[model samples]
Target: MTFADLALGEPVLKALREIGYETPSAIQAATIPPLLAGRDVVGLAQTGTGKTAAFALPIIDRLDLSQKAPQALVLAPTRELALQVCEAFEKYAGHLKNVHVLPVYGGQGYGVQLSALRRGVHIVVGTPGRIIDHLEKGTLDLSELKYLVLDEADEMLKMGFAEDVETILAETPETKQVALFSATMPAAIRRMSKQYLHDPEEITVKGKTQTSANVPQRYLVVQWQQKMDALTRILEVENFDGMIVFGRTRSITEEIAEKLRARGYSAAAINGDVAQPQREKTVNQLKSGKLDILVATDVAARGLDVERISHVVNYDIPTDSESYVHRIGRTGRAGRSGDAISFVTPRERGLVKMIERATRQEMTQMSLPSVDEVNETRLSRFDDRITAALGDSERIDRFRDIVAHYVRNNDVPEVDVAAALAIVAQGDTPLLLEPDAEPEAPRERRERTDRDRGDRPDRGDRPERRAPREGLATYRIAVGKRHRVEPRQIVGALANEGGLRRDDFGAIQIMPAFSLVELPANLSRETLDRLSDTRISGQLIELRPDAGRPQRRTDGERKPYRDDRGPNRPSFRDGGDRKPRYKRGDG
Candidate 1:
């Protein structure tokens, strides 16, 4: 049935029409009427099944725009999903004036959320953890919340967010209309519905949640650290019209997108923090062929229906099979054949089996493209490029004359001259992947033994002050122990802001007042400035090149040791009573 049959407001219908959403999915058609009638709904539908629109449309239709204090709240499992739901709300509410939808989640600074809350919001979509944080801080008031939605309810429970979810449900008004959507109805989820939902109208979309058969599923067993390298090789070899690389976290999406762009690929990232207008623009660019690769978190890519997307890459595998189904569904749309590739870490092998069991489809284990394969692909592409350039006979004739002149003056063979010109056209980059530059094999990771029990691991109290890796330089930032900042916070802030990967960092020493981190030595001024402005734990990072100051001991006291011998060896101090000499095995 059409949205009009459900009696939705004109603004929502208009927005839907503009979005080209004419027909409602089964779950939407069933859930919308109950929700509009103010009846609680328990929607059982898989991901990518128009679940967001089912709840979002009615919520927008029922929203009292004059009363701006969060009329509706949606809690999603991840920050990515939270932002995705928030974006959907904004899209559906476009015709409804002054309908502000804000998404709150972890890893984002609170200042933006606090300001938005103070200014008043019509709807708030957020993760359980961040929503709880705001509630505790009294920054978010849900007393006026008329509708409470738990999207991906099963996912929230699987992520161990059930406690936080219950706490949030407790805080909301008892009279609020609740819509609980889940892909699966596990026992725990069923109990939750019984506890939280008031005689919820049960609606289930029957059928096993499976991806399109048109999409050939394949997986690569790769190490967590080598995913980017594997992805680069895949991009080079795969013949794709458009691709979406799904990252598990928002920072990771940005990191992957940045790396792809640096490697000369047309790519961009979209996540919860990206403004709705920018997100829409990015999606439009992907549709219009202006962007080739979209690195996105699951939620950011939710409900993204682009017929041009011929491939989907799971740079980081989803925690659950449902998300995997949703991610791959981005491709194989409109009856087009698509390819789905997932990078599974060795530790996450079980997840693959789980997905196979859930979808009843075996994902072919695919090996990463070897160096030889990548080189072959590159040579093939280079040949095709030359052929395409030959089509431009006018330009080729002008360049050929210049090449002929060079060959005639230098007394070189015409073939040798053509080869030289080819080299010049190829530029400074190597024409092929080096034999030694292959990515680390995932099998090696699986075969690794645990460290010796006798060996002492590095502790925060005694951080090792080792030199940075080759081609890396030490940099210092002003937030540290005093600010209660962890190494991850520093990495997350820098990586998300600067578009660098986790491997880009070397040693990260969190000092009491400041922290020293190792980064690529050749950072551009613009990147450094952007990193410098990044905030960690509410404090500006103030990132800058380390001044090579004499290393300080963690403790207040220090012993005089020979600089050449290193800190492990004892040395004589000038003021000491006697010069103490130490020998091997000396007590």
Candidate 2:
């Protein structure tokens, strides 16, 4: 049924219609009504299943926007999810006046958030640590909070925020309605839900088999610079009614779509920045053959249904399996055969296995089309044009004679003249792709001069250092939670390339924007430099020797009492409470 059929207010319905959301997703339709009725809910759904809207709509509909001071609170596992939920609230509440949604998280200063809270807000979406920090300082008031949402509760437990989550739960009013959503119901999350949510109504949305069976999936390994050329070659070799190319960001989507159009392909970009009316027109054009491709981001393409989409190309591989499934699901509709192609960089080959496991389907590795194949396809299409014209020979008699007269009069060979004409007709698009080149072997990182945008702020107070080990030395890396860098990735990059055993890797502490790992101390400068060039999460590794001294805390500043657990203590992300995960066998 349409979103209008749900228990939503006029303002929310108006916002939904303007956002181009015509229908409720499986989770949204099931979860919204219970939440609006002031009942606690536990939603079992995977990513990309409209979980944000499911909770956001009902909260906005029932929220007393006039009575500010955070009537609702949402805790997310990551800053990205926190910001995403906050944005959804703003979008859904666009028609409602004086509704303020503030997102509080680390890596951002507190003054702005404190100011916003002082000014009064309706909802606060944040990560556990930052939210706890505010609560301890008495800057955040949850006394009036009528609704409490634990988004991705499993993820929170996985991130070692269970203790903090429990603390926050204890502080909230017992009368507050609780809604907990998790992709997987682990024992911890289940127990917490039972304890926190009062007789919650449970709703489950099965994610497996979500992808269509009629679609055949394949992937090609290529470098980042060669993606455009590879896409062009694949398009030439395949037959598609309409294709949707998915990119990670709005600008990337628009760039790919514009390039395709400039190369004479019918293409348009459907992104969040594009007005809803324009997005609808673009999608309609693809359906009507006015466009052969619609480049889009994940959110922009959500809930889009069309029978004409025969191919879905992952120009950029999705970071998670849920997104990959959602992208490929655009095709294979109406029981029609469809194709899903992914472009994987050599460094990202590991993701293929992850996607396969999630979808429960093997993805065949397809070689990139050769230059010869592209030239052959171009010539075949060129010949088809001439053959089709021959069917209308009578109508083209005058033009055909004009060509013959020019061929006879020109003092050049007929073949040469025809080649020149073909060159003119081919325009700017290259008829052949560049030869494929072998990629270099992976290397370790060295100290970097330039800061990665993902780099987290240094611990204002000195960071804890590991006690001196016999052969292992500590090094700091410039990527952590912000870049989505995990501990295994650090171990995998170094241990795999440096001939070090998994046991050789030592304690890893992941901070907001950086991490500390212990490796062999006696590594030469050359090895350090080589390691610096290694890639993780598509960003080059920026590693340096970790100084053992503690950073000095400002003399006048008041700092929270930190339980200085030893460096070997398991950080939160290692199943949050489990033993050290870097010890080789834990994985």
Candidate 3:
């Protein structure tokens, strides 16, 4: 249906016309009318289906730009998504002067956010963790908040932010209008709607049921640390003309892009932080064959119409199914088949299932590439390139003269000269990859093994352990013990941001005010850029190679080593050195 039928104001209509959106998607057509009537809405639609505008346009029409005090609040699951939603608001409200939009999320400096909040804004888009922080500080005054949007609701739930969402909803005005959008309606989400929404109009638009029908979707279940290796292998083996790599965050987009470029792939990153001019330039480069790959977050790649994208790799699995649909949709367009490869960790299997069920497609399970396979792919590509270059050359006579001279001087056969040339072309360090470790046995089998220990030999009879890995690069970040950052946070950010998994990290040491994280020596430059710009605690994480800082002595006057004690132990430290000893220990 036409956007005009949604009851949008003339200004918004003009903006839509300028943007070339003449009609609304199914979800938008169904939900906008009720929402404009001030009714609560529960919208179920796939990603890239104009879900953002469905809620955004209605909210823009309802907002009174004259009174700006965060009248509307939009909650997203990630910083990247929050920024993207904010951009959509800005675009729709361009004709409405004095209307301000602010995006608040973790990893950005609180001072900057605090200043913006104090100055006042018409709408606020934020991540749950950071939104809760602002609410607690009283810096965000939601007392006048008329509209509340939970965009990508299922994603927030999957990211373990459901509790945070509930708390935020409870804090908002009870009289406020609420809208929840998701690709799937899980039991918990439905229960949340019952508790928070009042007589909400439900709208569900079925996604492309067979996600794998025209598009070949596969997943490689590997540890977080090995994702890059898996991606590299897939890129080499798959015959792709152009590709798009989706990361969870803008930092991740930049990180993966940089790493791919370092590995000799022509890649670039496109995200919100990039200016409009630069973003368009990057997209154009990809479309014109100047760049082979575009590493992007979902928001950055939205509305990106490039038919050449033959492959889409999920460097980090999306938070929910809608995001998955939007990501893979970059490829398999214009009646061309596309390939989507997902790197899934064991813990994320549930998410994989959720996506498959939502999209009505089952992703094929694929084996990790063997070192031999990776090497062969590399060699084959190299040979093909060399052969193609040789075909257009008229240097046969020159080469023959040189070969004759070599044969006469060294008493070498013509075949021997050709063999020497092949060796020279092969180059050093011929794309050798280390084999992945075998998957761990099930816990039940391990428990049974323990019970049957009487029939087995002792550990003393086992062979000596192998030497530890070397040639690893250790990097340090400004966050440490004082910031209350945990090893898991670092691991999660690296995996989600840097596109490196648990196995990718060799070692991680979190000290107060700083952390030393080690990754592979051959880590891609894109990953490094991602880590550098990534924010933890709303501060830019300054990551650099660790130059061997002095280790804290266990027996020294430094903070006492908190053992793995029980709940009795305090989680944080005060200024005092009392070092309250836990009777049980910290877990």
Candidate 4:
């Protein structure tokens, strides 16, 4: 049905028409009516399902323009999403006058947010941490808040903002209408909704498979270390008008964009770190054809509707099926056909199956583009360049005369002269990839036997010792046994944040107040900086290069490495006197 059928206000309808939004999406069609009736709503929908507009339209229609002490407050998980929601509110309220919307997140200056709040903003979109800061400082008055929205509640909790979110919710008036939107309703999110929302109308938008039916999805099984090579090969072979590469983190997006630029591709990145204005400009560049590729994290790429996006490349597989749908939905817009390719590591093969089950469509397995295929694509493009240049007679005549003179003066054959000129045009880099440098074929998938499916024996508290890997250096991180940090937690955080493969890590040793682990010796300054700021179990890692070997503990200082097994469990020393639970003859 049209937005008008949803009974949106005339001004809102005008704005929607101006933006070319004719019909309501499924989430909008289901949730907008209940929201307009001033009831609490629990919306279950993925990221790109027009959720912002679903809530934004109703809020704008019900806004009392005269009252301006933050009638509506939207809490998002990240700065990029906050800005995006704020922009959506502004866009929907364009026809209405004297309505100000402000976005407050950590990175931007508080002075700007304060000024906007002081000048009387009707809507405030912010991350939970900053919102809590404003509320504690008494800078934001939410007593008159008529609407409170917890957007992406699952993501907010995942980012460790649950306490901050509850604090903000408590500050609002109990009678304020609340709407909670999430892609997935985990137990935590469900418990939150029950505690906060009052008899909320639950709406679930399902079957995004239909939305992406026109798009073809494919998967490539590649090692983590070879993702870059696989991506380069795809770019060389795929004919795309505009492409988006999805990375898991902000740093990965920036890294991908930088490498693409260095390879002579017109690319840019948008992430939480990028300011809203710059992100807008980058998106505009992509729309205008000045940029051919956009590398982005999921939050940064929310609500992106670019008609020319012909391909979406998932450089890293998303952790969930919903995210997989949202990432690919960026393309295949406006009834245009699109392609989506995901680089799945061997460990992530199960995720592909999950995605297929969720989408009700099986993804075709794709091999890395062969060297012969790349060379053929390169030659075809080169021929096209020559054909285009032939139309420019003046420049071609000048170059032809120079080549002829060189051939005559050097007594070289005309073909040899042409080959030399071609080489010069191609630069020092090889025009084609070496056949021997091709990536290894994907490993054959094997079914898990009963033995493989069975649980393995536990390895105990501390990991086994091993020799240090070549080109790896021991580094110390500041949270350890005292902080209740575990070895797996450290490995997961470091490996994921640093974009390092599992093989890149050598060994890990947990000490009392610190731990030492081996990582790549030649980590870039940016990667190191990112690792330093990473958090494990709500504590900073503070990663630094270790010096000297760890000293052995004396007899009195030797305590169990971990004390989490409860006081009743026997300690290492106490266990020596206890009888074996299983005697040798018992089995």
Candidate 5:
């Protein structure tokens, strides 16, 4: 249906026309009406299904621009997403006067954010961590908040921010309307909806599968170290139009993009650090056939609607199942069949299985490309292009004249001259790549140490320690050894949950009861509120500024508190209340 049929305001309709959007996507058509009716919504739709505009349009139309305080708050899982949401709001509010939209996330300076908050933005789009920080600092006055949105709800859940989300929601005005959107509905998300939402309307749009029945799917189980060589071999052999390579981090995205360019493939990186204008330029280049390959992080590639994408290569398997679906969903779109190749390291096979079960699709196993096969493919392409060129009548006379002149000079044979020309055309580098050795399996009965839990550096010296910022705040999370949590899991969860990059974090120490993490001083109170709702490993993580050491229980027992009435409660010590409490000096 058309935007007019959706009953959007005149200004918003004009904005949509300016962007050349005439009709509403299925998700938008279904969600916009109910949202305008002021009903709580839980929308389930895949990426690239035009979900952003569905919420943005209604939110913008309903916005009271004259009000200075933030009336709407949208929480996203990543900085890129936060920025995208802010951009959408700006676009839809173009015709409105004095409308301000601000995006808060890690990796950006807090001084600037403080100034913006002081200036009083009308709408705030932010990641959970930063939003909570703002709430705690009282910089973000959300008492006037009328609308709250949780975009990519499942992503926040997987990133271990479910607890943080809850905390943020709790701080919001109870009268505020809430909307939650996700691509998949995992158990944790459903539990969250039950706890926070007030009888929300559920909207589910099934994703269209585009795996070609003719194009086979295969994966090579290789070590992470060997992935580069394997990918090079595949590129040499595969006849693909603009392959998309997926990486888990911005650094890896840049690294792979640079390597591909160095190897003579037209490549570019798309990530959070890349400016929006540059990202648009790079994407346009790829669509126009100027760029042959693109390496990107999942957040950077969200809502990317490019039809020329032929192959999606997962340079690194995603940490969670939902990400796998989003990554592969890049290639297969609009009734076009596509190929997705995942590089699965031995340790990551379990993750692959989780993804397979989540997507309900079985991936086929294919052998790695041999050196000979790559060479043959390359030579075949070269021969075909050259043959096509030679078939042009205008070019035949030029080639014949050159051959005649060469044969007349120095008694050179035509065969020898042709061989020389072929050698020159081959270029300097040879297309021979050696396969890497397989990774060793984890030992069956090994001692478990901090290093064994994927905490140690994968490649390099011990991580250098940095002094904590003097004015920075330290927060504690109720996750430690008891929950089988590791430093990387903590780091990944915080980075992904809080929308903080690797650099945004400070010192970290893990204790038996919880882990303490350092964050910037003068962080927003709103950010802190969001952080409290973050969950790690399906458990609510209690986040609060360093309360200067928790008070010890006078009962003198080292065991954790147990409440039998709570859901999923831990069992009490044997003998119940009759159990003796250990004294301080007792062994």
Candidate 6:
């Protein structure tokens, strides 16, 4: 239905009309009314589904412009998302007098955010870490907060920001209307909703989640650390007129694009932080063939339809299957054949399968091109280029004479002179990387092998090889037998929500009052802190360092993981730039 029919305020309606937003998406249509009435909301939606405007519109309507101590707060996983949400708020609040929306994120100098907060802002959108910083420093106050939104909640959880998010949520007034939106609802996020949302309305939108049949889909299995090298190898040989590399975060997209440009590829970045004029210019450059590659985040690339785009590369696999389809759909439009390639780590094989099912097609597995193969392809292309140059030699008499003069004056062989010219033509990049010049693959991740322990031999019944646990720190969790939690449930929860590969997790010991799980000793203190908030079977986890060895069973029953756990699983964590620094309230 039309946004005008949703009973939005006159100013909001005026802004929407100016922006040309006629109708609302299903999620927005279902969510706005309840939110307007001050009810909590739990919304499930993927990127490009208009979820931003859904929460933005209603929140803007409820914002008390008169009291501007952050009347509404939105927490996003990344800076890109925070800025994107802030932009949506600004666009809709444009017609309203005295309404101020401010975006607070990391890397941006603190002076601007501090100044904006001091003057007062109606709506505040910020990344969890930066918001927590502000809150800790007493620079941000939510006492008057009328609305709280957790956009991309699942992403925050995956990034190990559960504790930071929860801490911010706890500071907001309990009476504040809360709205949570995510592409997927993990158990941790569900538990969070139950704790904070008061009789919240639930909305799930499953829209057209399919890729174009005209696109030839394929995926390359690469180690997480090796994706850059893999991408490099593919680009050296792959034939495409124009391409777009999709990264999960704005920083990463910009970094990748910048690196490509440094290496002489015609590339540019489009992210939420980019000004509208700059973003438009980038799109136009891509359309006009001035830029052959566009590295972009999903949100920034919305409404970017360019027929010149011949290939779509998922440098970072999408968190949701619908996003994958939407990403690849940018290509293969209007009866054109476009190639869609994804770099899938072993840990993310499950997501790959999920995407395949959503698209109703099997993606051909592609091996990463070897450095030698890339060199061979380069040589072949070089030969073809020389042939084509000679074919057009009729009009280049001057260049030929110049080359002849260089050969004679230097007393060099004609082949050597041609080689020198070829080197000049090839620019600063090497014609080929050595076979050994390939970047080292990241240390192989250990996969979790204990998802299904039911089919395994009893610990006392078998003598199997134990998996390696070189640098793991034993952690004691306060949930076990009394909680009715299965080993697989714990494994799945940690693997999916914790963003850890199955192999990254070591032996799991289930006892009566607590359980012991092995995690990397190198895990950051922030990650360890978040572990305390982890829940299994609806029971809170009180995690603490365990210095002692794992308890051995008296019955000679080994833990099922050491005995039955098989090979390591794949690790594909959909794996970010410095903004100008802001002053740290140290919050």
TM-score of each: 0.63, 0.60, 0.56, 0.72, 0.70, 0.54
Better of 3 and 5 by TM-score: 5
Q: Name the candidate, 5 or 6, with the larger TM-score value.
A: 5
Ranking by TM-score: 4, 5, 1, 2, 3, 6
lDDT of each: 0.80, 0.76, 0.75, 0.80, 0.75, 0.75
Clashing pairs in 2: 444-530, 444-531, 444-532, 445-531, 445-532, 446-532, 462-551
User: Model 4 Cα displacement at 266 (Å)?
Assistant: 1.3
The global Cα lDDT (0 to 1) of model 1 is 0.80
Clashing pairs in 1: none
lDDT of 5 by residue, 358-476 (tens): 66678876667766687678778878977987889787889889888979986988889877777787777653334443334323344678768787554335332333556555667
What clash count goes with each model? 0, 7, 24, 0, 30, 19
Query: Listing every candidate in turn, what is its Cα RMSD in Å to the true structure after a full C-alpha superposition?
Result: 11.6, 13.4, 11.6, 9.2, 10.0, 11.2
Residue 262's C-alpha lDDT in candidate 6? 79
Residue 308's lDDT within candidate 2 is 86
Pick out the ten consecutive residues of candidate 3 with the lowest summed lDDT: 578-587
Instruction: Put down candidate 2 lDDT per residue, 1-587, tens digits, no spaces.
Output: 98878757899999988877888988999999889898999999876577899998988998886786789999986665676688789989999998999988754667999999999999999977678778889999999889999998876765556767888999999899999999898998889988999999999998544677799999988878778878877888887889999987677898898889877788889765675468768877987888899898876786566778999999999867878887887887546789999999877888999989988899999987766777778778889997897799677787667678887797677678767777787777655555553233223244465576347665433343335356777677777779776665566455423434444566676666777777777776766765665455555567777653232344734444334634323223221232332432222
lDDT of 3 by residue, 1-587 (tens): 68887778999999888866788877788989999999999998777667899899999988886775889999986666777688788888888787889988765667888888788898999877778778878899899889999998876765546667887898889999999998789998999999999999999887454463668889888877777767887887888999999887667788888889888899999875776578768878998999999988766787576878999999888866766887888778645788998988877777788988888888888987666777788778777877886786678668878889999999988988887887787666454455553333222212446568777766446543222147566677888768766565565455445545334665555666787666777766766775686656555677765544432344655544444422122133222343332211011
